[model samples]
Every structure is written in C-alpha cells, then in structure tokens.
Target: MATEWLGLHFLFGAFLIGAVLSRGAGEHLPRTATQETRQVTLILLLPAYFLLAGLRVDLSALDPSGFGELALVLVVAIAAKTASAFAAARLHRLGSRDLAVLATLMNTRGLTELIVLTVGVETGILDGNLYSMMVIMALVTTAMAGPVLSGLLRPAGGGEQPFSGETAAHDEPLPARHAREETG
Candidate 1:
C-alpha cells in the first residue's frame, strides 16, 4: 500500500510495514513460525533478490572514461568507513583484534547501498554509468569484508590472544573492587 499509494520503493515499504508489525505483534508469533520465516527468507527470498538486482544491472554502462573516477570513489568510501570505525573503536578502548573486525564490518556496503542506488537511479539523481560504478563499488566492498575481518582477527604465530571475552587482552574481567568503585 505504501509503495502503490505513496510512491515509495517496494523494499522500503515492506521494511517499514514489517517493523511496525513486529513492534505490535512480534511476541505473539510462535517461535517456530518466526524461525521458518527466517529460514525461507534466507534460503529463497534473498537469493532471488540478489539475482534480480544482478539482472537489472547494466554492464554496458561501465565505460573506460569513468573507470578512474569509480576507482577513486571506491577507495575513498572504503577507507573513510574503515578509518572512522577504527577511530571510534579506539576511543572506546577496544582491543586491536576487535577494532580491526569492527573496521572491516563497517566497510561493507551491502543491501543498504543497493537500495540507495536503486532509488537514486529511479529519481534521476544518478546517471546509468555512475549508478553502475556505485553498484560495483558496493559489491567489491561487501565481498572484501569477510576475508579482511578473518585476516585481521586471526592470531599471529598462534601467540596473540583472541578477541573473545575469555581471551581479550584489553577486556579482562573487572575485579570486584574496581567494578564497585567505578559503578558506585
């Protein structure tokens, strides 16, 4: 109804309706039904969504003239996201491995980027060539996130502490005395 009547994107409308419905009736849903819905969404709907997005992509719009600009944009986007996340984590005194993982995750531009790009094209805010480049950028950044996070979180020489609660160097369990002092 939002999509047809209000000119909103189908994805956006569905998300808004789902959020509203969940707030009102999520706890009333049976656990099994929720689990099955999640499974179906993941196993079927998500793949179809990506396939449709890929089919809609216009590869012919990727011209050599804009290749350099696209590359620069991609680099800037990834770097800015990672750097900002890393800096914020540092301010919070997150461990090195945790900081790296956070930065890598922050660099990912996945479904949200696709939604924005789709809307931009629809509204004539981006030309086909620019839209294609941004889509490519989003794909590359999202694809890189997993591998980069694994590498960053991997222990070096099997000596480094893992980022888990039991092993994190900077996140040791607080002594009762210190905890009381801080909280009191």
Candidate 2:
C-alpha cells in the first residue's frame, strides 16, 4: 500500500519492509524457521520473479552491433565485483579458499540486479538492447557463483573433511560452537 502510494518499486518496498522486520524480530526467530523461510523464498518466489523478468525481455530488440558492448559490460561487472570482494577478504586476512568463496558470492547479481534493471528500463535510463545485455550478464554471473565456490572450496583430498575444528577455511557457516556463542 505504501509502495504504490509513493510510486516506489515493489521490490524496493518489499526489501525495506524485510529489513525493518528483520531488525525488529530476527534474533527471536528460531534457526529452523529462518531456514525454512529462506528455502521457500528461494524455491518459490525467486523462480517466479526471474521468469517474469525473462518473459519481459524483448529478444527482438537485441542488436548484433551491441555484442561488443554486452561483452564489455559482462567483463567489467564481473571483474569489478570479484576484485573488490577479493581485496576486502584479503584485508580481513581470510584464507585463499575463503577469499574465493567471498568473491564469488559477492559477484552474484541475482534478483537485485533484475530489480535494478527493471527500474532502469521503466525510468528510460536503459533501452531494450542494453537491458537485455545486462539481464544476460546478471544471469551468467549469478550462475557462476555456485560452480566457482564449489571448485574453490572443495576438499583438497578425498580423505579431507570439508570443515574442521573451530576455524574452518570458509567464512560462511561459522563453527557450531562459535555460532552458538554469538547467538547467546
């Protein structure tokens, strides 16, 4: 209601509401509840949103002359995002595997990118061809995150466990004891 009244994008309004709600109630939420919410959001809402975005894409608007521009955008976007994440991870003294995972995750464009592109198109900041290119770039970069992280964080040998001790190699999924301590 507030979103429509203010002429705000639905995604932006939803994000704002989520941020506020999380700030107010996140810690009180049970871990399993949070996990279930995330799983449902990913499995249901995300695919429908992306599919809608894809359907809106005007494939006929793609110009052959724009191929170079598209490639440039893709390269620059990926490089800039990954490089920034890598630098930040390095500054934090994270391990090589941790750095790779951080960078790959940070580089993912996902739904946020689609939301931005949608706004851009609606506002006349981007035409059909540019929007198409950016959408493709988002999809490619998001898709790369999983494979890249898996390759980077895979166990060094068949005998090695993926995680060990109080300080695992990756930054995500904090050691169980550490997580409990933090939560408490």
Candidate 3:
C-alpha cells in the first residue's frame, strides 16, 4: 500500500527489500529468530499467499465471448517466453537439451506472475474478461512446465526416473562455480 503512493507495485517494493536483506540471510538475527521466521512463513504466509492467489481467479468469471482473445493471449504468452528463453540459453552456449529445458521452464507463470495478476485485478487494472484470460494463460503455461521439462531434460535410453534427483543427469553435483552462478 505504501508503495502504491510512490507508483510502484507493492510486490516490487517487497522484493527490493527482501533482495537486500537476503544477501546475508539475516546473519544479524538470532538463530531462534530465523527459525521462527521460517516457521511463520511456512505456517502462515505460504498458505495465505496461495489461498489469496487461488481465490482471486474465479473460473466462472471468464467471458465465453472472449475465447478467441484468450486463445491468442495464451499462444503469445507461451511462445514469447519460450522463444526468448531459448535464444538466451543458446547465447549462453547451453546444450541443445538444456536449451529446451530452459525454454519449457521459462514459459511457466509461477507464483510471482500470479501475485501480479491478483494485484492487477485488485487495483482495477484488469477487467473481468481480461483478468480471466490472463489467469487462464498463467495456469496453462504453468501446468505445462513439469511434463514438458521432463520430456526435454530426459537422458537417452529413457530408463531414468522423471524428476528424481538420482537420475543420470544428477549423478554428479554441479561444480561450485556453476552452483554459485546459478544461485546468484
């Protein structure tokens, strides 16, 4: 709400603060304070966040007359995200398989997108039909991530387990430098 006064999304403000504070993972806090914070997040914040997201998207609010527009939005959202991620991964010299994996994952409208969409609806930036279309696009793209990435990242011979870290691809941990790069 305070951020809205400055014409910034509240989530973006929260994200900026979190990014700065998370740099040291709250080393200034006592261990019990850290543990309690995690507990509160898990026990209260997580469920509330998801519940808010779920409640904001009412499927019946979708306009039957807007099917064509919805279809176009979904197609463009998925295609644009995948193509951009694929191009970026290729530029990074990722392997062909990894490129596909990156593209598939990039298309997902995860919690961050959901939060923004909910905020849009709350702030009247989105009307019923438009919000419905956006929500549908987000749902469809996110739903595709697991199955699509599984197929894209699978190893040869197809015997490896799907999403189990014990698979051949996960046989060895990533190098420390690579892990650091990924985390950063």
Candidate 4:
C-alpha cells in the first residue's frame, strides 16, 4: 500500500479532483457551454491518455492463475457493489434514473485502479500478469455497471411509472408552446 501510494497515486488523485471539479462546473454552467467544453476536452485529452497508457503496458508475463484471481475479484466487486448501491439508493430514496447514474459512477475505478496495479507491479507485490488481470477486472466491472443499471431502471415508456404513488412525473414537459399559441 505504501509503495502504491508513492509511484502513480498522485496522477489518479489529480484526475479525481479534475473530474469532480469539471462535473460540478458542468452542473452549474449553461447546458450548451457545458456540452461544448466537455466535448472539446474529451476529444482532445482522452485519446492521448489512452495511447500513453496502452504503450506503457507490459504484456510479456501472462499467467493463468492471475486470470482466475481476476475473475474472482470481479465477481466479488460487482456483487458487493451492486448490493450496496441498491441499499444506498433505497436508503436515500433516490429516483431510478439518479440511482442508475450513481451506481455507474461509483463503479468507475478508472485511472485509480491502474495506478494501484502499476504500483503493485513496480513494488513486486504483484507480477506483470497479475497486474494485467487487475486492470482487466477493473475495466470489466466498471463497464458493466452502466448497462446493468440501465436495464434495471429503464421504463417501458407507455406511461409514467410511479415511484410508490408519491413522486410526480418530473421529467414530463409543460405545454409551453401550446400556451403561447393559444395566447397569440
């Protein structure tokens, strides 16, 4: 853990801070400005980071045991996290959409997982093969969250699915155009 803290931890910490701040800013900013800025930033920055990380990966020491361990870790991670998310969402009375988004975001280990794996490999706590397995686990677990949550939460769209007959259909739009037309 100490070694993991030293090597590449700062990179992920910085990334987390950046993501939080940017997302917070987007939430507060005008929709058009937020969309434009996010698009530009993602287009400019994401590919470069992906390329750099891919180029740095060591692929020589592949191992079967590591793969098995990775599978186990992924199973545990998803089961534990999904259960926890459901509990938390219920406790907070989060709407289905919000709960889905929260679940997806919580599963996104991203660069943080990579940093820990890299540190383990660098410090000999984990071999290259095991590190690779950890990376794979992180990616798979993170990627599944969105689709899973979406499947669970998505409405059929025939009508409003009431949340216990208490919550209103908040996303329903007002008849602004019809009102204007009638007034005019």
Best by lDDT: 2
Candidate 4 C-alpha lDDT tens digits along 1-184: 4323876555556757677675465576789997887798799777676565555455456567755776787888766776788678756555556555566666777667766666566558886666666777777877886676656556687444332211123333225433555799
Alpha carbon lDDT of each predicted model: 0.76, 0.77, 0.74, 0.63
TM-score to native of every candidate shown: 0.78, 0.70, 0.75, 0.52
Report how far off residue 164 is in candidate 1 (Å): 5.1
Error of 3 at 38 (Å): 1.9
Clashing residue pairs, backbone N/CA/C < 3 A, model 3: none
Model 2 scores worst on lDDT over the 10 consecutive residues at 159-168
Model 1 poorest 10 in a row by lDDT: 165-174
Error of 3 at 161 (Å): 8.4
Mind giving the per-residue lDDT tens digits that candidate 3 earns over 100-152? 77788887756767778877887889876777678778888999898987776
| lDDT for position 93 in model 1 | 62
User: Which residue pairs collide, candidate 2?
Assistant: none
The candidate with the higher lDDT, 1 or 2, is 2
* Inter-residue clash pairs, candidate 1: none
Q: Tell me the tens digit of each residue's lDDT in model 2 across 50-82.
A: 898898777676577677788898899999998
Q: After superposing candidate 1, which stretches have Cα over 4 Å from the reference?
A: 159-161, 164-181
* Higher-scoring candidate on TM-score, 1 or 3: 1
